[model samples]
Target chain A: MSDLVSRHVGPIVLDGGIGGGAMESQIRFTGTAVPLRIEIDFPHRMNESVVQDIDTAIDSTDYTDRLARQTIAAGVHRTGTCAAKPYASWTAARGERPADPTEFAGALTLRRMIIFPDGGRNNPERVAMIYSLPDTSDEHPIEVRFLQPSGPELCPVNVRPRV
Target chain B: MSDYDDLGGLVARMKKAAIDCYMAEDGFNPHWNDNQKYAKWGWAYHHYARPDANGEGGGSPLTATTTLEAQGSVAPRFDEIRSTIDTILTGWDTLPSGALCRAPQSSANAATALLGGAASVATVNDSDEIVRATETAMASLNDLAGSFVGPVYDKYCAQLLTVTQNLGTVYTILEAQYAAQQAMWPAAREDVVAICTSAAAAWEGRAAEIAAGARQDSFTVVAAVAGAVATVATAGVGTAATVGAVGAFASTTVSTLSSLDASGGHVSGDTYAEILASLVGALGALNETIAAQELELNRWLDETLNAMSTQLADYNLDAFTLADFSAGDGSSSINRTDTDMITTAMGRVEGALSEALRAAGAPPVSNPTPRPHAIGVGLAGTHLAASGVYDYANQCLQSTAAEYTRGRGLFDAAVADYFNTDAESQLKVTTLLSQEALIAEMGGRG
Candidate 1:
């Protein structure tokens, strides 16, 4: 009288993890290999180059879960943006830029950010993901871009099965 | 032709050929060295099923490992082997059937198992156990097929194809060089395999003599035949009953029964186990020979690839293209002579030797070949003698120019054949893999 079961966990996030078992494993197994870094500054945009309309920027999802579902949804959105565009970024971090590649081993990295506005400020936040081992001296940085779409915005779905 | 200016064109062409050979195997040109080529190559990789029909590589040694000079593009095949092994290991952590599915049962679901072992017993009835185990075994076989056929088999095949197709190019160059130096044109690499074959035959013949001696002398086929004749011999059909058979059993002659027993050769049952034990002991020694052959093959690949790389790197490629085709260790081709090319090739060989050593499926290293010639001198002398040969080869090219050339030819021809063979071989392996996958998708054999 035994049977197999599949249960829904929560939205999978790559930004700051929601700290659940499912989120933890996804980060370690799949995320670690993604070769990208993402950080989200809650409420404040990292760069001011892009402008946003405050009237259009409204939070539709509830924060009752303290980011278990919300964080994962954010990660899906960033991963989506990564697939859609070729990234270009100015990496000021040491070991971020290269002088000559032929002499170096190999270098490549991805930096993704989920942005949130700061207190009393209308600026969007940032979440950046960095991936690459030191042995590979390759320096190719792929920047992740996120657009806060208008209307009843949907939280991205985290597809991992919760344990 | 010795000019350096034409190198750019030559390298370009070589690079193109190299890339073409690489792409021919799996249709991805992972330069692995250069970025754009690597990226383009990487883009094509999306966990696609390998083509059906090929098992991946040819049975030829020359076809398997690439010489640095030839740019043998067989690394991917080996890579696939590594990954397949890894995947197989991953699959083993479950109910045998679950492993085939590449799905590990959750540890939390189980009560006491350490690894996330599938509660197969808990899930199914005893009647289905055999079915589940068979499904698991099938998956393991599939993993092996994929690894064996994928990058390892295909890379070797591409290499074989390129080398075989380029024989004409080698012939002309070697002919010109031989005439210039008052030397004979080098023999084909197949020549060496013939040498090895003859050598093997000679050894086997000698071993046969030894085996014959052991069977006749050491085996001691028959010893001290045993039988006895009894006095009270009676002419009767032993214990068989006749018309008046009241005393048929009691009146039977002891000698008659003994004679009947003696008709069949006398041998104790105890001897059978002894004979079997000795035979097993004799055959146990044969296993070492298998290990020895594997080691020899590894050594051949390592030493051969190392030398060819050195030679090719030094060769003048000026006449091949408007551009000088010489490549160095980031060195100038302005003075690229045969020595320089050979030297550069040696560097590549050295690199590959270390790489090959680093490679999996290496034959026995700590175990040296036992020398038959040292029967009188005993174990120590033979060990030294075998070690000496290995030591000489360690510097990369104790094998002379002639040997190197032959070896290179073999390596080239092998890869070319590998390419052609593997194109088909890979297809076959992939088909098997796909079948396995389909079976797995349908919940496997279970």
Candidate 2:
């Protein structure tokens, strides 16, 4: 079990797709290490079926983790669920502005998460998450952990891997 | 009475013979000195044979008051002149066995030397010096040939003329070859430099671009959002609602901005690296092309030198044969000996020249094929992978990295090869030019 470092890591947004809206979030860490990977547990208030669909959409197992690690090690930037078209679609349908407070918490629930390597800013690396954020005002407190070793250990971690 | 008359007639004929000898020896005009020709010939004979005599008469010795006595006196002097003339004629007839032979022989030798010198200069130097030298030598030979006049010296004159003329032809050929070489070397050099310089500039430019792009910091969400959006309106929502909405909206915009920022740059570090790799590959191909061209040039030069050597040898043999025939001795065997000696000497010279040409590795007469222009572009194909759409971006990075690595390795190898080749080429060109200068100097001496 990885140690969780709880903090207010936010300003996370997902935009682009059929819907013109965006998803906003304030994320919490369940771990503190490089590539922070985590499984999101949606609150009971959200629709069960919608939650299930989000779960299926953002789901990652040992296979996906290994695949992501392999991809990154090959000198590629691997994002867990950010590459998924369904996730992009979900964010866009939520509308340009944040939902009302009651709806905001449900919409911001996280299903899966992956972050890019730190770009030397001391801030968290770029994050790619599969979550149900229906509105721009969604504030999901997501749980994340250090995906041990973060990326593929075999891959170079330098700014320019090929260089 | 009859014996006295016969003696008088003999004396008269002797006077005429003496006059003819004097005119021939002194180069007097027969038409201008017709009346005095015999008188002058007799006077010279009288003066030379008997220093005590005062034989200064302008009239014919036959018309003198002491005509019979004068005729008697002048007969012995004429006899002596005839004897000397006979001796000279004998020397001319047996010329091949005496000093007279040296004239034609020396001229032949001079001709051979001039030909040899011209050939040497022609082989290494492409200049007008050899041509001028050759022309001077030919002129001298022609003058020597023209000096021999009269029927007695006809054969010798003909032989000298033939040999000299043949040598002139050889020099003419040499002059032409030198001129051609002078024009060819510089043209080829210019072409080579132009192509190589272009290639070097292209690689340098590509490497610099890659280096510049790699140094750029990745754009973060904060920068992207600030640049992307200006304001958020909150007209309908309550004060607290609007504030919460604004805060959430800010976070969402920032994250979206980050995604956009990552994808929007002209080329990623991986792609730049790939381009560098492609540049390396192009260099490798260029190096190979240069090597091949150099080799071809060397071979061509060797072949050309060999051909010229053979031609010079043939000319030398022909010149020697002509000299031998001109000896007029009908001694074919002796002529054969002389021909054999010249042939042997020429063979040695040709062999030496061939060896030297091989060592020098002469430049090509023609320009080598230009290296492929699209080498860099062709090597740097699209970096995207051949798989799933989701994997496209990552695949591009991975593929490009791999390509870059391969290209860089090739480029390094090419650079090494280029340096080595460049050094050798520089040395070769320097040596060849030096040799040319030396040959030119020698030609000037000739």
List, residue by residue over A13-53, the lDDT tens digit for candidate 1: 33344421112211222243232122223312222211111
Candidate 2 regions exceeding 4 Å error are: A1-26, A29-163, B1-273, B314-446
RMSD of each: 42.9, 53.1
DockQ of 1: 0.00
Error (Å) of candidate 1 at residue A29 is 87
TM-score each candidate. Answer: 0.13, 0.22
Q: Give a tens-digit lDDT track for model 1, residues B1-446.
A: 42122323332232232223233222222222222232111221111122112223221112111121233444465345434423322211110111111111121111112111122323211222222322332333233322232322222223222221222122221111112111100111111122222222322222222222221122222121111111001111222111012111212222222233212212221132332222222222222222222233233334333433443222111101112222222221112243233333433433332332222111124323232321212233222322232232222221122223332343333333343554443344344334323322112111
Cα lDDT, model 1, residue B425: 38
Q: Rate the local accuracy (lDDT) of all candidates.
A: 0.24, 0.27
Model 2, B262-350: lDDT tens digits are 11111112222232232233234333332332333233334333433344223222111111112222111112333233333333333
For candidate 1, chain B by itself scores a TM value of: 0.15
DockQ metric for all predictions: 0.00, 0.00
lDDT of 1 at A82: 26
Model 2 Cα lDDT, one tens digit per residue, A33-92:
222332232222223332222222122223233333333223222233222222344445
